[model samples]
Target: MVKPVNVGIVGCGAISAAYTTTIARLAGLRLTAVADLDAARARATAEANGTRALSVAELLADPDVDIVLNLTIPAAHADVALAAIAAGKDVYGEKPLATTKAEALQVLQAADTAGARLGCAPDTVLGTGVQTARWYVDNGLIGRPVAATAIMNHPGHERWHPNPDFYYTPGGGPLFDMGPYYITALITLLGPVSKVIGAASRTRSERTIVTGPRAGTTVPVTTDSHVTGILIHDSGALSTLVMSFDSAATRAPNIELHGEQATLHLPDPNHFDGEIHAHPVGGTWTSLPTRAGYQDAARGYGLADLTTTPPTQLPRTSAALALHVLDIMESLLTSTTTGQATALTTTCDRPPPVPLGPLEPRTE
Candidate 1:
């Protein structure tokens, strides 16, 4: 029997709970410690999850911690990841990788130099929904891919999130927060992006919180609330993206792929499992069976993938791919400023596909 990887988690916030839950269930991972800037919160989460509570520094240095599960906010992602890499531990974190490409590049450099494996979230792709869709495309169910569309629209996070001020900040907007899932899925299906043209709008300068104890509090909006862009994939496929926090509603499909012979309606990229429907030429839209990816996967599946990947190779949700996603997003925003199609400076090979079944113990 293989010994489970000891995971020390940093940032005991809302997302940490999901990771803790997943770690508990996945056979090859064990939650060993937890840390948060708020000691009380750290202690509470650790006690609840049957782990030790440590200061962030102590957790980083913990001898038992084989991997650092970083759930810190976007602004601190690079800092925490760098610290983990410096301590010679593999690291996985929630996405956007970092607020800016420059910072993200540094994290990538640090990991490469330290020979520490780095991975990032939006592992939702490793689940049945998107993977089944990718399988269809790869299997020629959608013949000769041409164009795609991805849309995500909502009022705003202030309606539900207690501390949503960060959502309006430079690193938070619709594109940064939600674009990763859609764009990453697109890349997985179509291939890497080469250039992009974007147009964006900030519908409101400030927003009022409508939930939690901070209800009625006003927060400044420094980033665009509505973002739309066209990604020119290296394979010559074009993906139209519409991500907006300003919209009250949208009827557009969450994601759709077009080809010479068919059109496919894909499940939401943010979810683990959902129906994938495909419409072939002169045929009715039909559902495709879950054909690829891990079954019943969850948020921390990437951490499981990271810990189990061979030391000589990167994980499917690798830092290289996350950095590429970040570059595409940052380049889109830059295009909004310059009013010209911006060419991407970074590109990554689509990581290997996940086979069906549990990621940890193989089923005979």
Candidate 2:
């Protein structure tokens, strides 16, 4: 029997609820504790989930905590991850890995020094949607892969999120916030990126909250609200990306990849399952059958993937992959400033594919 991995969650925020629900359903995981700077928020989450509430420091030192699920803001990701690694705990966090590559390297190095495993999010790609698409590519259904396009656009998060200040800060722009899902999916479908050229702009200097207690309150926009880039994969495939908070909307598919033989319309990388349409060179568009990945998977599946994976092997959502994704995003921004193509300094092999199966505890 595979023993359940005990989880201690740091940062009791919006994403924590989804993870909480997922942990309760997974047979190979247990939600053991919860922590936050706001003691009340942590206590409420713990009470609702039948777990103990502890201070952030206390939770990190908890002997019972096998992994620290970091739901902290991007700025605090490295600090929280490093602290957990120091305490001999594995860590998995929300995307971007850290605010900058320098800080991300520190977390990776710390995890290595302590012999602790590390992973990060955008695990939605491990679900049936992208996996089925990956299955097609791997099986040569698309023939020789050539190019891809990833697009995401929204007016702004201030229209919905209660606390929208962070979304406008350095680490919270459209590219950093939503690019992980698309970029990770693209990498999974194509391969590691070798070079990137980018252009970006911020249409608004400030934005106003349209929802919650801060309704009508304005916040500064410190990062690009619109970013476009072209990623040249090592396999010679190119992926065009458009991420924006400035657009009112877009009717474009979340992601689409073209090859010598066919064109694939992929579902949203932020979602687990959806229709995957394909149009061959000489055939009309049709929905492909799902042939891979965890069925009915959700947010915390990556943590479960980490737990069931052999210690000698890397998980599908390994920290190395997340760091590489972060490097790509950071490099794209740097390219926007330099007006020259940026070569990637970090690279990772595409994560091992997930074979089609029910979402469950694994034993091997």
Candidate 3:
């Protein structure tokens, strides 16, 4: 049998929980150690995940760590990932891979030079919600996908997050902060983006925290808080997307793919579970499940909870999607500022999704 991979996490922040919790429940992977600028936070996360606390240098230098998971904010992702590469460890980083495209490419290049693998997140595409949607589009359930839309909105994270200030920093705007998930999902369901145009602006210059330890504190918006963009996928499908921090919650669908014969309803980009509902050419609808709920929970929790099935998920979620989304966002911003469409260049190769399965009842 092949040995499990020993993974260390390089950031101990609010978002790290999602990664650590998932790692704790997986096989073929182990939570080897955790590192953070704040030693206490690293210790806490390390202990919680049954690992050790180390400084960034120590963690990277640890011989046992096969992969380093980078969950730092946008500004820190590239630096930490570069260090991991220098340490001869594979890396999985959270998105926007970097605040800029150049930095993202640098990280990718470093990984290549060091002979270390890189994985990035939003990886939402691997979730049943997206995989199921991909299957529908590929199978012609949604025939000749013509256009699609993906949307995400938040008033700002200050309302709930203990430290939401980063959401307003250089990399904190709606386009970078919450854009990756939906964008990655769109790319996966459709294909690589060939060109993009965007309109972006900051609705408010500053935001006040409504609730949290920092309640009443305020932060300035360093980037646009809202963005509307158009993308032309390589497959010739046009995609429109809206991301914002100024809108109140509404019933806007996460994604809707129009086709010559049918329409597809995709699930939320932030999660992996949902049914892909299809509207037939005759206007009738049917729902498809890529995997039952059991399949989703198993993958989200890591494959350890699974028993009956063979591996049904692609190993591309946690970092690969993040990197791809980072690349796409960089291109869009460049396209917007330069008033010209930009081709999203990339080298991340995700494993093909698990083979499509019978449309098992989603409720099961």
Candidate 4:
């Protein structure tokens, strides 16, 4: 049996709640400690979850900790991940693994040197919704996935997120922030990207935060606030991806895979459970069969089939999933700097996506 692992949380922020709740419910995982730059935040998070708070140093130093969930922002993701890996812990963090490809490389290096596993998110792909889509596409139910498209458009999160300034800055653009979920989900349904041709712009020089007490505070945009890209995946599938902070509205599905036979509908990127709808070429929509009661729900990181054979645990988009995403980020950033298409190493590592069984029918 795989031994149960002690888990730690490094950043106490808004998104931290989901990680903590998920960790609490899953077996083979235990929330051993929590930490933050602000001790009070850490304490509050721990208290809410019936746990203890440790300082950043103490949490990393604890021998009992096995997995450190890096809940820090895009800017702090790599640094926190590197520190955790060095301290002999497996790690998974939020996306665009680091601020730049260089920082991401350092994270991979740390994981490699320590022989501790590394990964990052948009774990949403591992959810039942995406996995079911992966199954149908790989099985030729869609008859060769020729292309994909994903779009995320919402006013900035400033009103709700207390520390929203960073999200409007360079490392926090739409592609860097919201792009990971769509990108990671697509890569899961397809495979790694080989190249990206980007054309981006800042529609607005500034955005005013609308949700919080700081609602009226204006934040400057230093990078591309609206990003559009055409990606060629190693799987021979092409994608049109869009992310923006300024769009008042967008009708694009979070993601859709267009294949020779049908189009598959996907769920939102932030959650794991939902319906996977298939629209046949000459027909209409139908729900694909899946494991009963498992819609949108998925296995956590320790469960993804990582070794290329049958996975011992249920299929999950866990830590390994995050690393695959980091590989994509490295290549996207490289293309931005080198002005040349760069291939991701993940193209070589990931096996063809395994297909999901048809959703089983339920009896009254």
User: Per-residue CA lDDT of candidate 3, range 1-364, in tens?
Assistant: 4255677888888878877676655555678899999999998987887789999999999999887888888789899889899989877777777887778778878877886666666555555787777767777776788999888877778788777778888777888887887887787777777678887878888888888778888888788888889988878899999998988885878999999988888878788677778888877777765642224442223222121123343344434445567767877777778888777676345335544432121121
Off by over 4 Å in 4: 1-3, 291-348, 351-364
Q: What is the lDDT of residue 49 in candidate 4?
A: 93
List runs of model 3 lying over 4 Å from the truth.
291-294, 297-324, 345-351, 356-364
Candidate 4's TM-score reads: 0.86
Candidate 4 lDDT over 1-364, as tens digits, reads 4445678889998878877776666555678899999999999999999988999999999998877888887788888988898888877676767887667768877777887666566655655676667777767888988999988887766656755788777678777788878877787777777777666667777767777677777888787777777789877899988887777787878888899889988878666668788999889998877522233334334222221123243223444445556556555655666677666565433434433332222122
Q: What shift in Å separates residue 124 of candidate 1 from its native position after superposition?
A: 0.4
RMSD of each: 1.4, 0.9, 4.9, 4.9
Q: For each candidate, what is the lDDT?
A: 0.92, 0.94, 0.73, 0.71
Ranking by TM-score: 2, 1, 3, 4
What TM-score, computed on C-alpha atoms, does each candidate reach? 0.98, 0.99, 0.88, 0.86
Provide the clashing-pair count of each candidate structure.
0, 0, 9, 15
Runs with alpha carbons beyond 4 Å of true place in candidate 1? 361-364
Scored by lDDT, model 2 comes in at: 0.94
